[model samples]
Target: MHITVYGDTLCAQVTATAMAQTGHQVLWCLVEPESREQLAKGRPLFREQGLDLLFADQLESGRLTMDFWEGNPQGLTDAVFLALQPGQHGLAAELTKSLASSTSTGCGVIVNQTTGPVGSAELLRDIAKQIDPRAFLVALPDLIQEGNAFQTFTRPDSILLGCEDGEGEALVRELLRPFNRRKDVIQVMSLREAEFAKLAISGILATRISYMNDMASLSESLGVDIDVVRVAMGADPRIGEAYLYPGCGFGGPGLSSNVLALVDALNERAAEPGLLERVLRTNERQKEVLFRKFWQFHQGSVAGKKVALWGVAFKPGTHRVDNAPALKVIEALWAQGVKVTAHDPRALADLGQWAQGRGELTLCDDPYEAAEGADALMLITEWKPYWSPDWQRLKRVMREPLILDGRNIYEPAFVREQGLVYRGIGR
Candidate 1:
């Protein structure tokens, strides 16, 4: 199959690369010149695990090509994947019209992989009908994670195809057959149902995380270890273990934004408030957990102190710092006349760009360099390197041997044995 992926989002890039790998010729069109230039230089606009290599390989094979979407795009593809961002639904509709105008046969499936609000597919279909009634439209919401986007897209747990027409469903299923090899992972449904299902999944995941974080706060007050509770809870066959870890809240553009979109969707449709609003509220407070702990540990005074952070990305294996908890912690520290030295395997460059003119932020390449002369160390993101460090060296380097384990990746007893005061969430 020859497919055209519209937009420059991570989902679009991953979809293009993965489709090309599965022996399909993929044309990735980006309206943004900078993003296209980055791809032209064989680099992904953002960092994702194995994305750089996969994209490079696909481009090298000539199976995947990228260009600007400047004109009509109808005969150029057997199918079109609309992978635009949340607020780009209007642009997607416009592109669909252009594609419809150029197609002499007026045949092609438009797959909606954008994370737009519910009923978005219906709107696109209505718009397509105005141009070419023969053009098929379907909703296929993307489920790619930031750091693990390639794996998630390549080996998705399930694939949802929102199509009222049999032909459109069959076309999408054939395109996704490569990823659904282990089992029958395709779920056929109406466009509205598929859009709502995607949002509901995000809402449920966010609820679980915020629920655990809420429990972590209670456990901290009651002197209970959230880790022990988390283990026992995961043992339950009904509850399961995924998204159950308590930490400094969940960040990332997709998860957080999806929850808010769900909230807005509910508010638009109902008079009553939605539960997801509370989930968003809980996560906002949870992001400040480390700062609150640090404030208490220092007896409400942290003036003129130097703090070190191990990871600044929202999560490991990526350099995305959008709405990251570490940013909140850094802001809190800096507001109180504290200097922050942060180190991440890949996020420092982006973080530095975000922190430019913020004053008192030092981006370091080495973790040990970040720890140098720090009053305390906070493990913000649980990167693999931060999981096991030279504890003795860390203790010797810091001005004060205080460790705030935001992710609870370290054992309290072992950290304490190194003569450092260790504080973990709910432990």
Candidate 2:
């Protein structure tokens, strides 16, 4: 199969490389010249766990190629996947129009991998029908996680294919056959249903996280451990415990955005808002949990203090800090006349860009270096390296041995035994 993926997002790069690795000819049409030049020189614009090697292998094998999107991109392949971001729906519509106007006589499938609002597929189909009625439009919402994207793409739990006709469904299923080896993993549905399903899944995930965070807050007030309650809840057959861990908050490009998108959709259709509105409010408050804890621990004053942050990324295994809790905590601390030293294995460079022109923030290459001379240490992201540290060295370096375990990765009793003050989410 010959396929063309349009966009420069992580989804686009992963789809193009994965398809080429599976023996398909893939043309990755980047959105700009900067991305094209980066890929042309064997450099990836974004970071993923093993995507660099897969991209290099595919490029060297001649199965995958790159080019910038200029104008009409029709007739380049039998299928065109619009892998643009949520805000790029206008570009997607224009590409559909160009493909429909092309002189190609054969049928083509337009796969909507972008997370657009409902009715977007219908809009694309209507535009494509103006030039060629045979152009098939399908909405295939992506379910890729940021840190573990390649594995998720190659072994997805299920694939949703949104098409109105059998031809489009057949073409998409064939294209995804390599990844659907374990069973019949494709779920066929209407275009609107597919679009809504993606948002629905994200909504449920956000609800679970916010629900747990709410419970964690209650547990703290009642002097109960949320971890014990979480374990017992997971043991039940009805609730198999995923996304149940209470942390500072949930942050990424997709999860919260999808929840808000659903909220907007529901609000437009109904007379009043729904429970998802509260879910968004809860998450926003949770993102400030660490900062609030730090302020209270210091008796409502963090002035002239130095704080050490262990991780800056929203989650481990990637350098994305779009809405990370670490950013919020850092900003709050800085505003109160506090200096912050942060270190993450991968997120330092990105965080440096985000923290530019901020005089109080320092980016450190080593976690211990960040801890040196700091008043308190806060663990923001639960990266593997931050799980267990040399407690003796940490105590020796810090001016104050106060530890704010944002992720609850350390034991309270154990840290107390070591003569270090420990605070967790709900312990």
Candidate 3:
């Protein structure tokens, strides 16, 4: 099937590659001319582990192709998947209008791969119906994670497709025929149900992170080790183990927005249990976990302090810094007139734009370079480089060798033996 995708920015690129990998031809329409130019020059738009490899394969195979459209002037496909962001949260309507105008229309499955809450699908379904009642618009939302979207595409465990009727359902199954297998996870459900399930899952995961952070705080004051608590909690067969490894907090594209949106929607409905409310509150407090610990240790004022920050991205293995706790803490430090030098393995571009005109902030290649002449060091992301560092060399470079390990990826005795004040989350 020669399908035309609206946006081939990042996830769209992955989606197109995934489709083309299965022998289907993909005509990816980028949002901007510059983006097309970048692709033409072979410059990648974003970073991911296995994306570049797949992209190279598809490009060579001629199955994946790129084009730039000034506007969606009108074309058609067997189906259209709106894998777009909530730019003013109005791109859905715009795509629907363009889809209506497309001359070669037919009975196809329009999948909503964008991450959004309930009611977005119903609204899109209504819009598609306005265009052609026969054509089906379903919310076969993508549950892809950052740094792991390609892996999820190649080997998805479950696929929840929401549709208005069986027509959309059957087409969706055919669309994802390459992935569906025995004990098929292609669950067919109502549009509303599937829509909310995505948000609900994210909400629950974020809540788990925040809840762990909350425990970490209590552990600090009560003289109990949160790591011990985590081990005990995960020991339960019913509980299992996942996001219970206590850290600073949860921060990323999907989790942050999804949680906040869920909280707002649930608040408006007045039917939300108090648990969701607490989750949002806890997460908000959780983002400040590292900073709060720093403040208390440094008395009331952090002024004139030279802080070394490790990890700029929200999490390791990716360069997305949307709601990273590292940025938040850096801003707070700047506001209080504290000097900060930060380092990351891969988030230089995002951090560079963020540090514009801020002469105090330095984005360093070497983590230890940032540590030089610093009062304290804060590990915001669990980058593998940070897990094992030359602590003795680090101690020699810094003025005051106090360490704050936010991700809890360090050994206590070893750090102490290195003659450093090592503080960590929970334990």
Q: Which residue pairs show collisions in model 2?
A: none
Weakest 10 consecutive residues of candidate 1 by summed lDDT: 99-108
Clash counts per candidate, in order, are 0, 0, 0
**TM-score of candidate 2 to 2 decimals:** 0.96
TM-score, each model?
0.97, 0.96, 0.92
Residue-by-residue lDDT tens digits, candidate 2, 1-427: 7889998788898999999999999899888777877768875677877987898899999999988888867345888889987878898898888877777533368898988899898899899987787778999898899888899999999788888979989888888999999998889999999999999999999999999999999999999999999999999989988988998998888887899899999999989879899998998899889888888988987899899999999888888898888888888888889989999988888898888886567889999999999889999999999988989899999999999998999999999888899999988
Q: Identify the runs in model 2 with alpha carbons over 4 angstroms from their true place.
A: 33-43, 104-107
Report every candidate's CA lDDT: 0.88, 0.88, 0.79
lDDT score, candidate 2, position 168 = 88
Error of 1 at 313 (Å): 1.1
- For candidate 1, the C-alpha RMSD (Å) to the true structure equals 1.5
Sort the predicted structures by lDDT, highest score first.
Answer: 2, 1, 3
lDDT of 3 at 285: 67
Superposed model 3: Cα runs more than 4 Å off: 32-43, 73-76, 87-89, 105-107, 271-274, 357-359
